[model samples]
Target: MTYLGFYILMFLGYINQLFFVPKVAREKHRDGYVPLYDSFERFYLRYVYRRVRDCWNRPITSVPGAEVYVKERVTHDYGWSFEYTGREVKSLNLSSYNYLGFAESNGRCAQNAVRVIKEYGCASCTSRNELGNSDLQVKLEKLTARFLGVDDAIVFGMGFATNALNLPCLVSAGCLVISDEKNHASLILGLRLSGATIRVFKHNNTKHLEKVLREAIVSGQPKTRKPWKKVLIVVEGVYSMEGSIVHLPEIIAIKKKYKAYLYLDEAHSIGAIGPRGRGVVDYYDCDPNDVDVLMGTFTKSFGSAGGYIAGKKELIDYLRVAGHAGCYASSMSPPIIEQIITSMTIIMGEDGTDDGMRRITQLAKNTKYFRKRLHQIGVIIYGNDDSPVIPLLVYMFSKIGAVVRTLAERKIAVVGVGFPATPLMEGRIRFCLSAAHTKEQLDYVSLVLIYNYEKDSFFFSLFMSFNKTFPVPSMAALNSLFCYRVIIFFILD
Candidate 1:
């Protein structure tokens, strides 16, 4: 009976109209969580599925390969399609990190990944510090530097690992690290690992950065004190959540004025911003050499998997020797490396190819069109106009979740941002746009954002009130009988 009620609500949830907030309100705590985590146990636990449906409502019948699919795919034995009751959906992929649409077709680089796989098989034989370093790996560092407009560069196994290992090596107990409040989690982890005095300034506040730098200078140079060792100011070239960009020219000036080393992580901005998509520095016309440290990921714009740090030769040289992730982790696979290397040729404007630049402009155009439409309908969009990452600020987390599910029913794929990923009160629905996304698909998403917001408010309010009245305990109470199953699941489902 419990399973029966659960399936019924789930059916309603996944169907059209509004069902998410009321269902999630019953399942997740007021804080937005539920237990029953282990994979084996989850089999019996038919969840209040919060996964956003990005593919248009067509059933995905078959997946051709990575990032490529046959339309209306049903059997997602792999890739984006999933076989649910025997229907196929060629999921229109918007949640993916492939920014340049390079992965959508079979290209030279895509074939290269396969060719390398045939040559090297799978997996790196050892860590970069040991037998794993290949000749191609060495060439990538130099190629990345030339492409990024920097003096030198070093590739990492992944973006998170780059920060995780580099932060500790660069900062120590005596140093002070000033970071933007909205910097990525990997950077936050790096700061935490550095054991330095960490002070968070307002996001993109140059004045506050100066104030902190002044305080650090004063504190470090006291009577009978030691000379200031170093200060590092970290900010993302582009923020992920709101799809906003930092004021780079000002940040660069401030960092120089304070004589502090600047760390710019261009995770989102790399393939999306600037004239040729070189990122914030390019947007501002600042010399890439002026930046003391620069890091970015290939997951998004590059349409590959990995990360890198490019800067002065000495710094890159030191990081290569001292960086923990560089030393300990397996070197990136030959295939993935080839993908990035091939991507760099196109991204660097070599061979007179402006395809990447053209794509960035197209993405910006689509984003503006969608965001403007939402604004016209009185839907608030968070972040800058040019960014494809648009956030719809909805205070209720469950509603954000429900709206994602609601939009999915409409064949629009979107994701929710709330709880630990974002502040609890700032819960929102995040629409991560890719270059391959069509105008029609985005138009549907823009409309659905407004449609679901109005449709779910009533359900959201009811569930919010219900949860406040009677909070849930562990699953231990769930299997037991309830006088009113409707009332219980609506409150504790």
Candidate 2:
């Protein structure tokens, strides 16, 4: 048969079956769980998640940013590409928690790790409560508290598991934990596990927080025999999703007015904000002592894999042997422990290079540059301009999903926020900037983003119409060229 005839036959055959296949797939999608077919779930996944999956249907390989080794950092980093995200794509790695870009190094730190391996022999095989408690771990906690300006601190293996088990251990059913509506999932799960009376305030709404605090205080007046001894106000120093900062001063005032314990999660803020990058607390010039309990994760900014909680020595001392998770979970590896010490030294301004100090300045400049260029193009930005985590908002959820898949072709990496992550109409592409991103790279990325934004309004409208009538394309001819829509995040900040 002629080549043209074969093409004609294949097109017709596909068209003839398209009707029955979609119908059957839709019916079965509602009933069956397709391992790889994720679209059929009860609730849809975010655009970025779906886009990454759709783009790499079989297996996605990643191109390395470096040739050698080091830490578990963000994005298509050279160190981690031999590394995570099996797709060999050259991307800026917007999804990683390496907020401060310390993961890209192995020089002084790697040498130390090798030395520690020879000294410690690589394993703290038992929990801290068990034989695993070493002098290093003890001194590490003390050093962390001093560096963070808190009274005491305790380090743990898993950030999520730390909270999943800690919150309940601290608060009881009688205590009312006033939580921020936008707190991380770990906080939510921990609150639920604790079986405490949870009151969610409007996200970053000090007035709302005050109202809840007042209500709790008032209710404890007469009939309440316990008189509500403790009120823990929970909020993040920097919100992970939007990169928005908390108004700590106002929140602190409200906490004081109501006599509540303010728990600030400095997850994304530490090593990225404040004097010498001491996190948001320093940025605000607020006394670290004012904050009742400070919890931060080393996975972010710090180039390690653990979490810590710092507060009054008495409280920390109680939590050490008191918490079940800490007593049972394996201690953080000697390598991570050593890395934390080195990383803290770098960020705390003990090092000569002053790289940590410069990183914060670079990130601030990059963030402003990206926001300014995007704003000039009239692209909506969410969160503070000073923040490294920027969100470009897109109001439509379904089409926002399509844009996530499209941006990859531009060689830019972005994450999408939709549905469960944000409100129904709040869909965005989260652009995480880093110190590692050079001015030229950012300049190019900004221009490409502008080009996408300029055509976005018209492109999404047209793509949605075509996609409605077409298949998502079989084996997206990676080596071939075609057109798709790209979505960026939209935020009011």
Candidate 3:
């Protein structure tokens, strides 16, 4: 057959299947879950789960920046060469968590990374305990300790593993871990790995946290009334998903009252909040000593990899000998360690300029301005006023794809978050403001919101859904049906 004829045949076949397949799939989807023993279950999995999908996981940028091009994924073939040519279009970036805009490549951090890469090569050769402790690593630990006003600090190769692996060393079977209901997945996993009895309090609710702590302390274990070996209160300085700041002062008060050790995860707030970007301890003017363990990652604000656990010298020493991650995981590369060190020095004003302060100021300004503009445009946004992360509600499952694709078409880059990152009806588009974003870029976002606000567009629908004043459309009923079914079939199973 001729090449043109073959292509024509393929197109026609796809057109036929597109119409017929969806109707059948929607019927099966609406009918609900197929029993495990039924033969049709395999057909349901193949048709519903595999065939029905959206254009996600596409490469959105050449580098991390305020603007960049993205490759569009073809819905059917799952091929790369469909919409993306060699050239990339510039799109405003509100997706990356580069809060202080330190994630840039051509800055001092990059220069330091290059210098270290040339001097020490790429990998650290082995784990920290197994011939991987370099002079640069030691320098980073000391600098981190000094920066956080702690006696000492220990570094881990991976941020997620730092929490998951170290918790086992910190707490054991008889311990009780009181965590925020909306704490990140890593903290939840860490608590699970520690084999501790876990109790959750409502997110950012000091009263609820106190109540839980009081009950845990008084009631003791399930029935025996034996006191817990250790009671650790785990919470984030800032909730990444909600963009809300933790009520650190109140939490610390509760921790003190209960004689509980407080573990503060400053992953998002470390390099992003505070007048000096020193995190919640600085932001709230709380005593750093009040926090038993201060955990943070370098990826968000430092523009590097790895994580750190900072506390008293004794705890640092104990973790060095006991923490499985530091002992088993590969050490951070010299380049990454130097990158973090360089970023830290800049933040500490050791680079001999007010650049760090300027960055923090600019980030704060941008966050405030963007949020104010969003509020003025009459869109419901989640997070604190000072928070760099802003999430706009987009409740319906269908609108998640529609809104994301529409924004992409408008040359705006943002992340569409859905279950199980949030509840099924609470899906949203997350925007991370950075110091790199200019006034004009922020202005454009406001313009977009205002333009759609007046019309009966997706943004209008979203705003109405969030406001609670406007009634949800009957269309939401159809959307919820599929959303619930998918949740049950995939998550509950």
For TM-score, the strongest prediction is 3
Q: Candidate 2 on 1-493: residue-level lDDT in tens?
A: 2334334534554564455432222333445653654442411222223333432222223322211121222335211123344335555555555666767545666677678888887887888788887777887898888888878999988888778778888787677899999999999999899877788999888888898878877776335546764678989988978779999999999888777888889888888777678888889999888898888888877767888889899879888878876678988788778878887887777877787677778777777887776665466778887788888887564345556656666666666676567775576778777776777777676656644544554554554455443222122321111244322232222
Candidate 3 lDDT, tens digit per residue, 1-493? 2334334534654565567553332433435765434544433333322332443455865656666567655544532124445556578888888887877769788888999899999997798898898999899999999999989999988899889988888998889999999999998899898888999999999999999889888999877889999999999988988999999999998888889999999999998999888998999988799999999999988888899999999999999998897678999999999989998999889999999999899999999988887775556789899999999986654456667767777888788876567874576889998888999889887766554445435544444555563222223432443455566558758
lDDT of each: 0.69, 0.70, 0.80
TM-score for candidate 3, residues paired by index: 0.82
**For candidate 1, which ten residues in a row score worst on lDDT?**
472-481
Stretches > 4 Å off in candidate 3: 1-55, 77-87, 455-493
Off by over 4 Å in 2: 1-52, 55-87, 221-226, 456-493
- Clash totals for all candidate models: 25, 23, 2
State the local distance difference test value for candidate 3.
Answer: 0.80
As for model 2, its CA RMSD to the true structure in angstroms is: 11.5
- TM-score of each prediction: 0.75, 0.77, 0.82
Q: Find the 10 residues in a row with the least total lDDT in model 3.
A: 469-478
